[model samples]
Target chain A: MIELTINNIKVKAEEGMTILEAAKTVGISVPTLCHLKDLNPTGACRICVVEVEGFKNLIPSCAYPVSEGMVVDTNSNRVRRSRKTIVELLVENHPQDCLICVRNKNCELQDLSERYSVREHRFAGESKNHAIDISSASLERDPAKCILCGRCVRICNEVQKVGAIDFVNRGFSSIVTTPYNKGLNVSDCILCGQCIIVCPTAALREKSSLKIVTNTLASKTKYAVVQIAPAVRASLGEEYNMPAGTDVTGKLVSGLRRLGFKKVFDTNFAADLTIMEEATELIHRVQKNENLPLFTSCCPGWVKYAEGKHPEILDNISTCKSPHEMEGAVLKSYYARKMGLKPEDIFVVSIMPCTVKKYESARSELSKDSIPDVDAVITTRELVRLFNMAGVDFTDLPDDEFDNPLGESTGAAAIFGTSGGVMEAALRSAVFLITGKNSDNIEYTEIRGNRDIKESTLKIGDLELNVAVVNGIGNVETMIKKINSGEKKYHFIEVMACPGGCINGGGQPIHQKTENVIKRVKALYEIDRLATSRRSHENEAVKTIYKEYFEEPGSHLAHEILHTEYFDRSR
Target chain B: MNTNVLEKFPQNDRSALIPLLQEIQENYGYLPEEVLQQAADHVGMPLCTVYGVATFYNQFRLIPLGENVIRVCRGTACHVKSSANILFALETALNIKAGQTTRDKLFSLEVVSCIGACSIAPVISVNDEYFGRLAVKDIDKIVKKYSARKVSVSTANENQES
Candidate 1:
């Protein structure tokens, strides 16, 4: 440890630690914009400039290391003036349309300007007039409002490993965009939207589907049926004043009902259905020894990535539609028939904690008879905004139950919000189907956690099952290489696009600190533990639906409605 | 796109990016989108990163250059002497803004940092020929002269073809 004087107070900081990290340890937070934890600091924003004794220039604390016996003044008059000047310059080039911006109160730049008390710009100069890019169905890009912080670029390139956008040009002409300034639709963007969460301003955001939902709710001819995803109940409370990971499932149902939805359903029912189809498919593959490691097809982001980057493995993926997609299909077909309404009259809107689901809903392959399975997808953030717009006090609402039949789910479906939840849920049902009894252990702790890639072998009766669970698409290259080399063998694999799975999905409420993601992950686990039924096959609604409608899993009717095929999109 | 051209460079190494882009730009007058994608594939870099590097330097162009290029210096000396007014006048007369080519492809305008001609106060260079001590009134005459030269060159080519 090295001793230093910070603001006239003597403090000991660890060796090789940056000044910003050391200051935080002493309960002092030096503001930063481009300093993302666990990633290399770019220090391009220069907002964390601090004064040090014997140094002529103010050093960026985020990148500068602490020296022995150094004296640092983080809030000196000189530092204050310099910081204020930087804000002034940034504001001069930035647009003053904060009142109408998407991230009005939540923007980091707006927060910084308010804290620094920046009223007017001192040096007003030429500002770039770049147009917005709204070609992609999942996301929107506005270069005019960008502050050039490079956080979005860093997250998209390094964290997601999908460099669909980057800093183009230099100096005043620099803007973050796709190659040749083309539309993002033509680019290799998987529409995962990880960039939207890390952006400091309204430069990047998920496309708003709120207006369409509101219009559909007011229409007399249409009946707006809504379904909420499993991850949303774990993280949507963060948008309100509630703490992160607070389970607001009951309150969420009440709030959606207040918003004038005809019926409120749970996507977990469809998740249970997915587990039934996927596990049965896995067993069939194992018996035939055709496609050994059957990949999960629940995440739209991972599905699209596989379609684009590795089309050769398209056959290895399960044919089951995602939970929300399956829910929309069931709602339009069975629910519509029961209610005596046409599929066109029933507008299915899904409240998801994912941005890629919006794009997935628009896919022509997921549609039947030229009508989409799901009409619209609103993120958790959008749902929060809708509740606020409708004057619904989300936290104060009374606990209510989801509508019957489609709303009921099992504990295994609730855990699907986390990383290894799918693999665990599948094993619970696969073991029961293969043998005629339940396993001694239910948790299957081997494939659980936030690990990049987890591999395990378990003996279920006479067969030794090999399985792997992967989170974060950035960590998939090595596993793909290993699989291609035939060096590793596995019977099942679960992949989620976002790190930590749907609980930390791209469309969750934006939190500067990443700890909320961990909290959300734990919340889903708690929900799973408290439930009565712990397996997909045990879901009463699922068994009833199979007995009444499809007869069994992977049946002809199930294949037509619950299952789908893949396309060769590797261009 | 001539993707076969990328096989000449070493694959999967980011260090080969600059040289690969330079060769592409040399082969084609400006960097084409398809060619840049090919180069990105060769270097194992993202297309966005390749585009960012290509756009960072003013030496690289994304579109083909016009027949006659006009560069207006906006250095400190020229800016203080009202180079902004001169640039605006040129844009008005040509009906095109800076960093854009005219519809007929006869002329293009660009804003440059400095040509080391600060002694002249305001300088506008056209096709390597420098025009010093420029004024707002001089834009029309310069554009007319270039327009007349282009017409003459086209007529000369027509005569030779016939």
Candidate 2:
């Protein structure tokens, strides 16, 4: 431990802790923009400059280590002046379109400008005026708004291990861009959107589906059908200033209904539907001893990652489309049939807590006869904007249930929001399928939490199933290496591209604190705990859908509608 | 498509990325897009990252150098002597930026630090010939002289000299 005096308050800090972190311990919050938690510090932005007694220069507190008996002034005249100057310089170069910016209120740089009282521009710096990258269907990159903080670059290269973009050129000429500054569509970008979540400005965001969704909703000829993902309910409440982990599913349903949707369904019902087909597929793979390790194909980000970097494992991936895709296919097929509407007449909008779903919904494999299974995908963040645009008072909105049989789901479906959830959900029924009885133990505590990789073996009936859950795409290389070296073996694996699973997906609310992600994960489990039925096989709606349209799980009709194929996109 | 540049290097070694790129540049004179992708596959790194590293350094070029290459010295000595004007004069004469090649592939202009010729401040070298202590007015005549010469690759000139 080291004793330091920050702002005349004597504080004890652990060795190797930065002055910014030490100050944080004593409630002296030093604002920072480029310091990503648990990642290596670059000190790219010098906003957290502090006055150290012995130092002649105002040191960046986030990069400076706290020493014993070190005297520091975080908000001294010199420190405040330097920090304010930094904000002014950044703001001067930045575009003055905050009112129309996607990250106006939630932007870190904007908050800093407000905190430093930067009412007027002091420096007339030139804007880079970089062309915005709207090449990808999922993400948009407006480099004009970038502060050169390196958050998005770091997240893309280091955290996600997808070096789609990097710091190109040198010094004042430096810009974060893809190879040759080509469109992200032609680059190595998996479009997971982890960069969007870490970006401090409006530089990175999802491509707007708002205009299309709104136009489609107002269309009298085309029926606008919407589905809400399980994670959106777990995290969207934070947008309304509600406490994190608060389940706003009912209010979310109410808000969507008020948004003029003809019918609002739950993606969880499809999540349940997914489990039935996936579990059967896994059982068959296990029984046949072909494609021994069936990788879960629920995460489109991971699916795309596998398609690019590890195409060898593509066949091992389950052919089941993601839950929302399943819901769309079912809605377009059976639901449309029952409602006496043609597939072309139904415009499916999925409110997903994912950015890759936008790209996933456009996959040609998921479409039939040029009609996409899902028409437009709006993120959880965009849905908040949509509600605000429509003047829906979300807080005061009465709790309302989701529409019809498609909205009903099981407890297993609710847990699909967090890491290790899909595996656990699949196991609850896989055990029943193999043993003709439900497993008394529902929660596989060994594979839970935010660990990058969690693997466990369980005895189900006479078979010992080896399963693994991968939380983030960055940690996947370890699994890939182990599997290739024949050192580790598993019967099944569940992977979510973003850490902590869909609750912390790239399309969710812009939350920087890790606690908020934990809260979201816990909220999903709470929903599962309070649910009446805990197994996917027990979902009456799923059973009804199978009886009404598809004959059964893994049937010919189920394969045609619910399952899809992958392609080798390796560069 | 010849890849003898990587024959001696160990396969699947990411540490060899720079050495591999240097070898490719030595052979091809400029990094080709297809070869860089092959290098990425060999080194187990992403193609974009390889492109990033290739571009981060000033030594590597994605396109071939022109037949007439001009290097304007912007070192500590030359910069004080107003080499900026010389570079701007050259850009105007050549119709290209300092780091870009001409649209006709006849002239390429680049700024260099020093070429052991600081004795002559504000110096520029065009195709292995140096012009020292030159004013901005001298650029048009030098450009005309290079344009009248026969079309020859800069690599062929270097090869013949070596």
Candidate 3:
């Protein structure tokens, strides 16, 4: 322990803790832009600079280590002046059109400027007029608005291990962008959008599909259908100032109706469908001993990562498309046929807690004859914005149930929002199908949590099933190596690109507290626990779809729509 | 993108990024995308990260340089003495934008952060020959002199030995 006097308050700080962390214990918060928690501090932004009693220069509290008997003045007049000056310089180089920006109310830089009372720029100079990269299906990168905080670079490169963007060039010309600034579409970007979440300003944002959705809904010729992902319902309420873990599923269904959408479908129905198809595929593979471990292809980010980086294991991945994609395909095909509407006339929009879904929806492989499965994908944040634009009060909205045929789902489908939720959901149904009896245990707590990688061997009936759950795409390489090297054996493997699965997805609301995200993860489990049907096979809608249309899971018709192929994009 | 340069480094080592990039830049004059990908493959680093390091230093270039690279300084001293006009004149004379190569690959104009010759305000160095106290009127003559002469591509350090 190190004794330090922070702002004249005598306090004891943990040894090796940064001055910023130490100061926080004493009710002092040093503002930081580039200092991401748990990641290595770049100290690129000097906003967190603090004055030491003896030192002449203000030290970056985020990077500087706490020393014994150190006297720190976090909010001294000199420190305030320096911090204010830094904000002024940043603003001088930054765009002043914050009123019209996407992150107008929820920006870290804007908050810092407000706290420091920075109204005018003192040293206005030449700002870089780099072109915005809108080529990416997922995100738009506006270099003009970037403050060069390197938060996006750190999160994408360090945390996600994608390294899609970085601090390119030097000094004034420094901008976070993909290789050679040749646009993100052609680059090795997985389009996971982890960078968009970490970005402090409106420099990075989702390529909005709200305009297309609104136009499609208003069109007389177009029969617009909307579907919401499992994770979205848990996180969407956060955008409306509601507490996290608050199940806005009822309100969300009601809000979509208010947005002039008559047909509102839950992606959870398709999640149950995914479980059926995936479990069947896994069983077939296990029985034949061909592709012993079936990798989950539910996350397009993970699928793209495998395609681009590990093409050798492409065959190991399940052919099933993600839940929303399956829903879109069903909406265009079966739903369209039932309603006597052409696939072209019906526009399917998916509300997802992911930006990668935007990329996935636009995939050529998922499309047949140039018509994509899902037409447009709007993020949870974008949905909140849509509701706001339509003058819909989310809080006062009456609870409404999802539309029938594609609305009803099982509790297992609801749990598909979390990290090991897919593996658990699949196992719950797989065990029942294999044994022809209900197992007392439904929850596979062994494979749960936000661990980078989790592995477990569970006794299901007579077979001991070895399964691995990769919570994030970044933690996949080690497990992939284990599988490839024959060092480890597994019957099933589930991977989601974003940490903690879609519940903490990149397209979710910008959370000021991580507890909110944790609450979202728990809310999914709570939804799973307090449901009538807890298994995928028990979902009446899924059973009906299988009986009426697709014959059964893994049938020819099911494979045609539910399954997709992978390509070697290893550039 | 040549294989000979990449095979020299040990594979899967992140520490070899800087030296490997430096060697690649030295061998190929500029860091090509294909070669950068290969280098990243060799070091087990992402191509974007390799690109970031390569671009962080002005010493490295993504695009190939022309026959003669004209560097116009934009240091504090140079900027104060109307270096923007000097750069503009060079761009007009070369018929290319700053930080761009001429259509014929004869000249590549670049505005350097600094030339370190602050005493000689607003300086433009062509290859090795330093032209201090540069004026906008002298830009055409300088461009013509370089274009007319037989092209010789060399750095300022190699031939500018006093």
Please provide, for model 2 over A180-207, each residue's C-alpha lDDT reduced to its tens digit, 9 standing for 90 to 100. 8999987888888889999999999999
- DockQ (C-alpha based) per candidate is 0.84, 0.61, 0.69
Best by lDDT: 2
The DockQ leader among the candidates is: 1
Q: Could you list the CA RMSD of all candidates, in the order they appear?
A: 2.7, 3.3, 4.7
Number of backbone collisions per candidate: 0, 0, 0
Tens-place lDDT digits, model 1, residues B1-162: 456568778899999998888878888978888888888888998999999999997788788788999999999999999999989999999899888889889988999999899999799999989999988988898889889988998999999999
lDDT for model 1: 0.89
Across B1-162, the per-residue lDDT of candidate 3 in tens digits comes to: 367777788899999888888899899888888888999889998887888888787677888899898999999999999999999888777788887888778899988889999998889899999998989998989988998754443344447873
Best-first order by TM-score: 2, 1, 3
Which 10-residue window in model 1 chain A sums to the lowest lDDT? A475-484
Where model 2 places Cα greater than 4 Å from the true spot, the runs are B7-19, B41-44, B118-120, B151-162
Name every residue pair that clashes in candidate 3. Answer: none
| Residue A19 displacement (Å), model 1 | 1.2
